[model samples]
Target: MLRVGVLVSGGGTNLQAILDAMDQGKITNAEVAAVISNNPGAYALERARNHGIPAECISPKDFPDRASFNEALVAKVDSYDLDLVVLAGFLVKIPEAMIAKYRNKIINIHPSLIPSFCGVGYYGLKVHEAALARGVKLTGATVHFVDEGMDSGPILLQKAVEVKPGDTPELLQRRVMEEAEWVILPRAIDMIANGQI
Candidate 1:
């Protein structure tokens, strides 16, 4: 089985989708071995607990520097025998060391189509807001490999959603998330498993 690890910093909606996909056999050879979060109160940890999956918290504040924190995080991931690391909603800027360690083994799901409303300081509802302000006719989610640059990794998959007139950020977010959790994420995982990535 391909052991997967997830990192999250908020509600585990995407993590839940992954679990559902696993339960339905939509992802054939992967299992989430652990879920790690920087915040102890993040609900993603609770979601993992509820599913009987091991969960952990490793805060950057606990370490002296970014490198130290990343070293600890990498250690925790390694303990789980993780083959792939999925960043669902993790907020931290991953250290270059970690990127070097995991390389293409790490993947992240972004709220926007990327290279548009992505990069530092663009996350969550902020991405949707930027897209709306630009009067974009279409916007969606992207799943990409994790690299040293911010959200500049090679795209694994992308799903587009039509931007409706008079759409609120909330509405667009809801629609984008639906496609993200159901389609883009699963397809990316399948590609990795099948060596098509």
Candidate 2:
């Protein structure tokens, strides 16, 4: 069985989906070993706690800079002896060193289909806002390996959500989460665990 670690910054809606999948027995060969968050108040931590999973808060502010913080984060994750690391709504850019160590072992769920509404500054509602501004008819989510570049990794799974008429970024974001991100993220994890990716 694969032991997975989750990283988050805000509400762990995707993390919740993964736990639900495990509960439903969809992912039979993997368990959530731990959950870590940069935001101490992240609801993801609460969800992990509810399930009796180890939840940790490692604040970047505790460290002096990005390198130090990434070092600390990598140490904590590596300590778990994880088979895979999933970034679910984790806002911070993972450092190159961590990416080098984990390589394809780390994966992240993006708010939109990559090469579309992605890159350094594209996250959260900003991605949806960009899609809406471009008047796109369809936008969705992507799950991919975490590399040194931002959202630039081998695509694993993708799911599309319709861009409804007169939709706001908030609405699109929610729909995409429910329709795309939440769905494909778990599927991607299971695939990796099964060596399908």
Q: What global local distance difference test value does model 2 have? A: 0.92
**Per-residue lDDT over 67-171 for candidate 1, one digit per residue giving the tens place of the 0 to 100 score:** 889889878887988889999989988878778988899999998887889998899999999999999998999999999999999988888899999899999
Each candidate: what lDDT?
0.88, 0.92
Error of 2 at 90 (Å): 0.6
Output candidate 1 Cα RMSD: 1.2
Candidate 1 vs. true structure, TM-score: 0.95
Q: What is residue 166's positional error in candidate 2, in angstroms?
A: 1.7
Q: Where is the poorest 10-residue window by lDDT in model 2?
A: 188-197
Task: Name the best candidate (by TM-score).
Answer: 2
Please list all clashing residue pairs in model 1, or write none if there are none. none
lDDT tens digits by residue: candidate 2, 1-197: 99999999998999999999889977768999999999999999999999999999999999998788988998999999999999999998887888888878999999887889999899999999999999999999999998988899999888999999989999999999999987898888888788888
Count clashing residue pairs per candidate: 0, 0
